[model samples]
Target: MSRMNRFLYSLADGLKGILRNLMMSLMSFSMLIGSLLVVGSLSLLVVNIDAIIQDLGDQNEIMVYVHEEYDDSEFNQISQAIMEAEHVVGFTFVSRETALEEMKNDLEEYASILEGMEQDNPLRDGFRIQVDDPANVEAVVTAMEGVDGIGNVEARTDVVESFLKTRNAVNLISIGLMVLLAGISTFIIMNTIKMSAYTRREEIAIMRMVGATKGTIRLSFVTEAMIICLCGSIVSFFAIMFLYQELIEKAFSSTGLLQAVPFQEVWGGVLLIFVGASLVIGVLGSLLSINKYLKV
Candidate 1:
């Protein structure tokens, strides 16, 4: 037979094998879908948590208040010192006059009550400093405190630290769960293929007696397993996406307390992961079963 004809014949045999062992195949399919859903859900959770942490970091900044006695040249020196500080990406100086004006505008309903306070502005001159990374904010704050003429330095160190800790904990937990699920899925798939091979032992033996090559036998079994896994992966992908969109609409959209990373931004990568994992698991499971049960 021609190579193309042989390939087609093997694929046909694979489909027959699946039908011949419909119950076993369905069990494997169901287990695979469940595993993929759990893995995908964990992955999405980690992705959204990382996104939230990044947004928080971007919005965080340090406020450095300078002594009221400092004149323009002294303030200029202080600004220069702040810019030169470690982890300081940039800084903007806000004079007491500008601060008072901003306060009045923010409290517009009571603007008249503060109309005569410009000459005795209670606000102090300060710099709003941006750091290179949220993780380094404490370092930047420490560096700011050491700068001459700077009276006080303020930062949201507690919030940043809490977010960082949460990110690390989620990553570790996700990794552990994925590994456990993959192992369980692989084991169940292996047993399903093994049972299929055992049921067709007579047929496999006859083919071997007729001079069938080991590769040909292996291909049919591998193809059968892969087809099963591929179906599960595709179904799981769409199911998770639908459930994720529903969650975003019903829960995340109505609240400003939490924000989710859009599914569109991550679906491509998630699909690739699912498909790739399915193929690998399918091949691995089939080979192990065939080698031990059929001795192919």
Candidate 2:
């Protein structure tokens, strides 16, 4: 028989063996799903949140201020110099009128304090420059200094740095949790598979005496493990979909942090994690358990 056929036949036979212990298999599958859901959910949450944070960081562009009395020719020269900078991604000019409008929108509480001060608007007009990377912000800032018509460059360095630090800390904690949960999941699945093997020890011995190859025996157990794991993964996916839509989406949309987190992207990431986790747990646990039985 072809290798493919052999694999299918072995898998089919394994399914039959598992079916003979239907109640036990169902119970094991349930446990696998629960363990994987815990691990996969946390992994998905971390990855999605990290992506959102990165998007926010990417939008952290530098705002370069210009002197109020600076000439138009000097302003154009400075704009051109910023555009030609090595690390410059994009630059947008905020005219005096635009700056005043922005200030008005932000400071509605102090409307009376500046209700009629059109000519007294002290905010400087400037170019908002975006760099290729947050790390290269200092390079961009240094390049902007002393450029004609530019008063000073402000990068919001402290705020962006704090955001990066928080992102890294969150990612680190999530990674630690994922590793711990993965270890626990492997332990549980292995024990469950071992129990299955123990329960079928006599049957396995009988098959061995009847000239069953180790490959066949191993494949059968592995098939059982795969089934259990796949079922658990499917359950976790639906559960996450429901929870994400009903709980996370509904709650966050009301608060307007919804745009900060893209729902579909997060869902896709979570689905991948859930499926990948299921496969790893199912295959690894089966291999470990079947190897022990093969020695006997």
Candidate 3:
């Protein structure tokens, strides 16, 4: 038979093999989906945590308060000094009037009690300074303390340090879990393929006697494993996306407490990873399992 004909025959036989051993095929399919789900869920969690950390870093800023006695020229000098400071990416001046107005808005229910306090506004003008890196916030605060006309400098270094620690811990744990699950999944798949080949040993022997090439026999089994894995990957991808959407709607969309990374931004990478992993596991497992049978 021609090589093309042999390939087509093998492919058809592979489909038949799945139906012939439906129960085992189903077991393999379920295990693949389960493994994918666990890994994918953890991946999503890590992505969201990373997003939250980034947002917090962006929001973190050093507050530099100016003494109430500084004139406009001194304020301009202070601004110039801040702009020249190392690690200072940006700074916005908040006038005492603006600060008082913001406080009034925040205390809307008690606005009447503070209606006449504008003339005697006790708020101080300040600069909200953005650092290029959160780790350098303390350095920037220290530099600002020596600047003339600056009364106080405040920063939340402890909060940033805590967040960094949490991110590291989460990443280490997620990576360990993913590796463990992947190893278990691969082992299960390898054994399942081996058992399937064992059940068809008689047929394989007959094919060998009839001059069927080892390549053809191997392709048939590999194709069968690939088909099962592909189906499981497709199902798991959709199921994961569905669950993510549900989570976004129920937990994040209405409450506005936490933001989720949009599926639109990540689905392509997730699909590619799932499909690639499935193909690798399928091909590797089939090759390893069928090699023993083909040795005869």
Candidate 4:
């Protein structure tokens, strides 16, 4: 028989063996599905969080405040320095009138406060600069210090700092949860594989007596594992789509949050992660159980 034909026969035989032990196969497949679903959900959450952070970075803008007594030459020099920074995308100078007008529009409740300070307004002229990285806002602010006419710099520092810290914390939490879930899944899958192998002990012994090579014996178990995992991956893909549209998208949309979550862009990655995770768990479980049974 050709090598391809032999492989096909071996595959067919392996599948038949699994079908012959239908109960064990179903149990194994069920465990695989549960494990992969958890893995896929975590992966999708992480990916979407990362996308949200990217959008925030792209939209981040910094405001540099200039001192009251500083000369126009000093302001020009400070503006020129900021414009040269690599992280800076663009910069615009906000004149005193313009700043006052913006504040008047934004602070409707404080209209009297502005009217009282018409001539002696403490608000300073400033430059609004957009940067490539939200994380680099502090660095850009630091670079602007001591340049002529610079009184104090405020670029949503508190908001940006909080966001970075929160993003990192979320990532760490996601990783911890993923590791914990994976361990539980591995334990469950390993137990299931052991049970399946134990129940087929007699058949395995008979195959060995028939001069079956160790490779063939091991391949049979591994093939069953891969089939279970592949099926679970297919199922998890549909489950993720349902969850994304029905639960995730709806919840965020109701709150007017993450209006542009880029669901479709991240969908492919989520599927890839589920397939890869399922395959790893399945292969590991099968190998471990097969090794233990062979020793027995």
Candidate 5:
């Protein structure tokens, strides 16, 4: 037979296998749909939470206070030294007078309480340093502390540490969950494919005896698995979309800051990953399932 004819026959056999075991095929695809949806949702949640943490980290700057008695020239030197510090993106110098004015505006109702303290404002001059990376904030703080004319470094180390810990915890949990789900999904898919291969064992044996190549039989089974996974991935995409819509409505109150990633922006990559992963699962499942039968 021609290669084209062989291809046609293999495609036909694959479709027949799917239809012959309709219930099993449906169950396999359904499992894929559910698992993929869960994975996609978790991925979006992790991305959104990370974004929120980063936004909060950006708002909180590293406060480096200079010596109160430092002259203009000395302060300039300190500021230049800080700018040269690693991870220091930029710095703003707030003088004692400016700090006093800000304090007054903040405590307008208690203006009388501050009236007697104006002659000896206790506010110190400080440089508000913007950190280039939140992960390096401690390093920036340590570097600032070593600068000459620097009196103190006021950093929310606890807050920064907590944020970093949250991000790391979330990341570790997400990775673990994804790995577990991938393994389970792959196991189920392999078993499902094995069932189909087992059903056709006698036919495969006869084909082998008739001189039909082992490659042809493997091709047919692999093709069947691919078709099942392709359909499953496509259905899973729409199911995920529907579930996400409901989730945004009920699970999320307002789509302001902690919103999940928009499906539109990520659907392309999601679909690519879903389909690619499904294909991998299907192909490997077929290979693993067909190994014993190949000897026939």
Candidate 6:
């Protein structure tokens, strides 16, 4: 046969193999869906945590207030101290004048109160500190308290600590769920592939005896495995879309602190990775499991 004819023959054989093992195909599809669903959900959870971290970096910060008696030039000492402090990513000096202006803008209703303080602006010069890591806010706060020119360090440790706990919990969940789903998928796929190989034993044997190379026979089974995985991955992608939409509506709509990353921004990458992982698992799993039958 010509090379093109040979390719067509192999392709036809692969399609026939998939349709003939309809029951096994369905079983494999179900297993893939279950596994991919858990994997995708955990991935989304990780993405949410990362988004929360970025938001925290922007919205939450530590304020290191300079002593009232400290001279403006003495701020260099505080800046130098902060530079040496661990976990400090960035800082900005807010002069008393700037602080007063901010207060006026934020407390417009109490503009008179702020204007009254203009004669004696009680607001001190301070450093707005940005911690590089939310998890290290406590450490950063502790260090800030010791800065030489600082009178007080104000960090919302409570909020940062809460997010820290959540991050750890989600990380643990992702690892545990991934392991569990992989095992379940492997178990189901192994069984289904064994049954598929068994039912097609005669066909496989005939192909082998009739000048068919082992690689050709193996290719057909692998193709079927890939087909099943692709279908499951597609289904799981849609399911994830629905789930994320529900989360946005029911969870994020009420809380601005937690915003959903738009699906359009991340779904393409997520889908690419999901399809790649599923294909690797499907093709490799079949190649390994179907080997005992082929002896090739």
Give the residue spans of candidate 2 off by over 4 A: 1-31, 54-59, 68-77, 105-110, 133-139, 145-149, 260-263
lDDT of 5 by residue, 226-250 (tens): 8888898998888877777777634
Give the least accurate 10-residue stretch of model 4, judged by summed lDDT: 1-10
The residue-by-residue lDDT of candidate 4 on 130-173, one tens digit each, is: 88888887788788775667777777767667767776876787
Q: Cα RMSD to native, each candidate?
A: 2.3, 3.5, 3.0, 3.1, 3.2, 2.9
Q: Model 1, stretches more than 4 Å misplaced?
A: 105-119, 294-296
**Whole-model lDDT values for every prediction:** 0.86, 0.74, 0.85, 0.74, 0.80, 0.79
RMSD versus native structure for model 3: 3.0
Which portions of model 5 show Cα errors greater than 4 Å? Answer: 1-5, 97-122, 249-259
Candidate 2 overall Cα lDDT vs. reference? 0.74
lDDT of 2 at 245: 70
The TM-score, computed over Cα atoms with residue i paired to residue i, of candidate 2 is 0.80
Question: Residues 165-243, candidate 3, lDDT per residue (tens digit)?
Answer: 7778878877897778667767777787787788899988888888877888899899888888899899999999999
Q: List residue ranges in candidate 3 displaced over 4 A.
A: 1-3, 71-77, 85-87, 132-149, 156-164, 206-214
Q: Is candidate 3 or candidate 5 better by TM-score?
A: 3
Error of 3 at 207 (Å): 4.4
Tens-digit lDDT track of model 1 for 151-197? 98899999889988987888888789778877777887888788878
- Every model's TM-score: 0.90, 0.80, 0.84, 0.83, 0.83, 0.85
Q: Give the per-residue lDDT of model 2 (tens digit) for 72-176.
A: 788779878998997898989998789888888889998777676687777788998888766577778888885877897888777656656766776787678
In terms of lDDT, model 4 sits at: 0.74
